[model samples]
Target chain A: MKSHDSHPHYWKVFATFAKNSLIRDMTFRTNFILQCVSSVGWTLMNVGFYLILFQYTDTIGADTGWDRDKFFLFLATTWFINSIVQAFFMPNAEEFSELIRTGGLDFALLKPIDTQFLISFRKVDWSSLSNFAAGLVIAAISLWNLSARETNPMVPSIYEVALYIVFVFLGIVIMYSLMICLSATSVWLGRNQTLYNFWFYITNFSRYPMEMYNRGWGKPLYGFFTFVVPVLLVVNVPARILAKPIDPRTPSEWLLVGWAFVAACTSLLISRWVFYRALASYRSASS
Target chain B: MLTAPTWMNWKLSSWIMIFRTALEERLVYRGDFALGTLMRFLPIVTQIFLWFAIFDAIESKGENPKGLIGGFQFEEIVAYYLLTMLGRAFSSMPGLASGIAKQIREGEIKKYLIQPIDLIGFLLLNRIAHKFAYYVIATGPFALVFFLCRNFFINGMPDLLVISAFAISLLMGFLIGFFLEAAIGMIGFWFLEVSSLLFVYMLFSFFLSGHMFPLTLLPDQIEAVVNFLPFKYLAYFPAAIFLEKIPPEDLPLELAVEAAWLVFFIVVCRLAYGRGVKRYSGFGG
Candidate 1:
């Protein structure tokens, strides 16, 4: 009898898959390098654009507690989360629709490993990780500048650092769950070419400081993205944790930090339910 | 007093037939493009929120917000961005350059070479048809959004002369966008994959063309240099003209320069395509 219970060597399997992906990438060495360079180039333009904007104002908004350096740190954290999503989840999410259209997901379901695990871990686009390295350089520089502030230098505490790490991981969980749900729509819709466009529209909300959305006409968008989609916490909580010291005066920021955990867990469960439900409805179009 | 080429002697009805077929094909995919166009406006909504916060901060700082940085008021900046979106819709060639590169790489240009129809002429007609179909579907959403945001226009309307000038630049911008992308595509004859180069080109065009922000927002030194470059005509110049950023005194000269750039691109693409076709060889049927 064939054994289909589980594979104990999931990590080993992932490593091998990653190794094969590297090999495939190396086959087009110039393309891989160009991809890295182009991504970095785009990031630099964004930084430059904001640099000019900073010349006009000391902060992104009035009394939002974000200075130039803090905003850079927040921007770097945005890059960190984005790089991880684009490197790992985005490629898989893009392929998920194609698999459904081609009936490849049926074969994926028959595998010995967990369908989600096998599906998500299959390919690793290392070129996308160049942005993560770029983010790290920016983050380290921002940290140094933050510490070197003459008057009110902000050095992160151990507790803050711990919270930052945990929140970053939880942020990834929330983003992954949202992406999986979007990809699951392809099973019903068939040939989901708009996946990337929708992803871009959704992530555009999370990229800026959440404070930017707290004002007049933006209030509706702030509520919708925060409560319904919960992307606001994806970068906000961790970036804020590093950029500022914990203040007992501000209960709302603390409330957000607490909510990230709840949001992650809820999204995880909702995504699991959605994925299987979509799978149950999936009818293979390819022979 | 110049006679057109022999290929131009083809019957008008045949040209009309080709144009109609391409238009119909594009119309079949109009729903998808219309949705894509509508989704694109989401960024502008975000821009509104962003700029409002920035200007609000400036307003709190107790300065006359009318003539702040880059010579733009809060209301004008929003209107400028809205206008640039329209300019981009006109000048964006989408997959034109890369599609040409792909055709050249895959030997699909063989069909064009073997046929009596000129490759450039055929592609231009097809693109015009495609654009027609897009504007047909996109006009509704664009009209609604522009109407809603009409209050952002501090200066309500311009005279007939300015309106005519703005319309002329937009048409020229479309032709310039086409020829510029086609010239880039001709590079496929020399390189197997120009998609990466195309990506890099797009990055620069997106930045330098003032699609991201007003060219005037750049430091004065950089703005002076950028004003002379052809890139501005792509997205910036038309919108700038419409916004009355260019004074009436300089309008005629600016239009002349824009016309010169359009002619320059047309020449460059024709020359490059000719040389590329000379070296192109198809291996199999």
Candidate 2:
């Protein structure tokens, strides 16, 4: 039965956005290609930097189970999560302040569709998706090497694979939630040009293994990020599910895994609340 | 109707005026820069942890506390990273190239051409003023961070000579950094958008400048090739000198080569500006 819905079809709206973004990207085809190449080069340099470091150590931390192949998988997971954030949300987030400054948000608010959805999906940086492709290549090579290096050619169980896929999606959602909350602050702050730099500082933590932050003063940091902000789980939990299975003895690790689900739901709620709250405070700049 | 001005005095006064205005302009726009300066060093926390783990693991294997990797003992490695950060703070030209590209693309270069001011000289003054503002704001944060990481400096303080050398290298590094980026930005005269080119330059520059790791950590052949390039002077050379890695005898030669690179870049930038201005057609203001 065709029900009369008052709201605009979000899927159709999204398809239009995708089409417009593709058109925009094609208009600067050379620039789009160059950006992809540049991104790939940077990723390759990161791989090289670690490859150099690995010459001195067996793993990222002292026997923390991030042997190079596993670490590459972790890096690949980071690339995947980061690429999604960059491709889908970063351009929009960066423009959020501009929209506020130019009173574009006022027009957006008047639209029938949801403001948050409109704000977040307004543009896509297709060039950033190259990092996702690069991540796939890295993940594939590392997985092959990992299997070849193992005595029994370790194959992940279906349960582990299912959990990994779910956790990765959750990780992306947590990142998006964090990004949206940050982006929403532009409504209050007026013109937030330094958002990119500040964003980098926060998310840089998630690029590495969480176990690397397990020692000394790092303990409290680990706790703060894991529980409070949950950036620690963005890449770690999902990658860990594939790289190394959680030992039943380590109840805390298991707890962290379970809490990630709770964190995802809570983060989404908090971000939505923050977004609307920010919107309520937003005085229209347009006359 | 005061009197006839001395050329040197007039130039000096104008320079001072430019610098003062630039300083005030920076202060006016400093919404997050003061805090951003401190936040920029947040990565030092990660560096400290990562180095400690690497050293600990290596030392455990041989039961030797002072095991060397790429000619850097554990403490020296930590100190090297810190010193490189200091050097980068001095030498990094954040928006010099892209800003220049924007000016060229939008035909804002006409302002420099029509005015009495020299473009490169004006920009140099602006950059110096920028560094001055940065240091004024960042000194407290830098002092606090360095004091906290004092344990990393296991080697006793360098003699006066090395400090002087480090200071000289930093000054030279600043000049080299400015001209190198300006030269790259001058390409905007020929190309409408130089971002892709700038991106490539930045990626290679960061990697080759030894910001990621010590130059010695690279294999011998790659190290030799990298040393042949001017980039190491920007970050690695200053830090290496501060760590007293250069022998006293080789220090003079190293400084000479750095000075040579500086001269080379200044020439290239000036030449590019001349050529660019010759063919330059002003577009939309």
Candidate 3:
């Protein structure tokens, strides 16, 4: 696969993997359908919870500009990014330890492919796409509502929309990097039982706007998550780009965007380094 | 009738033995418990920030700046979350449903069928032990956090009556949560996969139990609806008792309702297990 990488057939490889995943999902039709229902049900329930919350309050943050509709867009963006990550990488991370235990990693290593790509995209949870669809609908509806509001007409330009997509893509990359880093740790830990639990706890912070963490005690947390973990960038930057709750032309806003791009690149490099190091430490079961 | 006493004594002793063994097993992983508990508290950071943001947004510019939103002052809300964390420590069944489903899927559940052991009783005893160990191990972290946020409590520690009610609610919540999850797990005997159903149950419980936010923060109609649900007993009711959110006059009725829900779930769990056993098909050796 490395030898043929110059042929520019990456899309073909991804398509094959996706096809295989869809076929596997179809084999358990009822289970797949139920999973889809469950995912969508959870998303709707989340929306309902927020709806209830917003009934008593006008905005999530004071003057930070995450009003109800704009916050919905943020939540929708969270769902979108999280769904993609879960669909593509979460299941792989979950099974990483099992693969290690069974010497499946040895087989993977032998394959003529980029090990990271093979490991990350091995399983695609098609059912998670239900949440993706739900998120798109919610985001669209929220954007429409925000734009149509009489008080402030915050219709995003095409360039802003493009930047929003780019930031969202960067968010996915950062999330994927974090997941792969944890999954790689299975090489040393033998069995990382807390992988998903830790992931859930860490990513929980990212679901809310980063502005929420700009206050007194939260300022330290913001610094740590922004610099060390980089989770704050996952949802906030893209949501900010689309919502434009704060002036996008502001220096701080531009700084955040630049910082997010830097975080994405740094995280990818760090996780790749960790994966290779863990690989070096790995000993096959037979050995 | 004459042999009932001896049989009951024997069963009680066995359950005690099971509980002790489970407790011992749990203690072996105290380090993991402590770490996991501390990690779980990480979410409170986000919650604190989020609630602070909400209160800041709702701040009136002039007189009565201390106006309580959702019938809770900022400090009270923080205190409520601390109590809720303690409540969850008691009632949270992390893997109870899925564990049972896995056992059933693997045909290991046949061990209970063959033995005199009652599955639900065994599971309940194990969970009691698990919670016991968790509280013992996690108390330090809980204390540190609570001490740090001590000012959040409006009146500091509650009186004996409130504490007793809070304890009772937590116990009842544990039983309700266990039986509810066990009943869901029993569905695995009938269906090849119960994961989706379990997921739905978890989603509902997370919202309705006020694990995410105070039920009082919800709309009045929805709060009323949540009040009727057994889930509120899991995390919210115990915390509410600690906060004195429920009126003294209403305490007895609420406790009775919680007990009733526990009884209902217990019966459902038994029925499901019994019927499930009838349909059991063996799996891998």
Q: Pick the candidate with the highest DockQ.
A: 1
Candidate 1, residues B4-49, lDDT tens digits: the string is: 6644555466689889998999888777888888888888877877
Better by TM-score, candidate 3 or 2: 2
Pairs in steric clash, model 1: none
Quote the lDDT for B58 in model 3.
Answer: 77
Worst 10 residues of 3 chain A by lDDT: A1-10
For each of the candidates, the C-alpha root-mean-square deviation to the true structure, in angstroms, is 2.4, 2.6, 2.7
Q: Candidate 1 - CAPRI tier?
A: medium
Higher-TM-score candidate among 1 and 2? Answer: 1
User: Can you tell me the CAPRI class of model 2?
Assistant: medium
Residue pairs clashing in model 2 are: none
Model 2 segments more than 4 A misplaced = A1-4, A150-153, A245-249, B1-5, B63-65, B283-285
- Considering just the first chain, candidate 3 attains a TM-score of 0.96
Please write out the lDDT profile of model 2 over residues B1-285, one tens digit for every residue.
Answer: 435577667778999999999899888756477778778887767776777777767776675556788888878887888888889988899999999999988778899989878999999999999999888887877788789878888777899999999999999998999999999999999898998999999999889999988989887888899999999988999999988889988999999999999999999999999999898998655
DockQ of 1: 0.70
**Per-residue lDDT of model 3, residues A211-279, tens digit only:** 788878778888998999999999999999898877645888889999999999999999999988988
lDDT tens digits, residue span B3-121, model 3: 99999899889999999999999899788778877887888877788878777877843332775777888788888888888888877899999999999988888899779997887
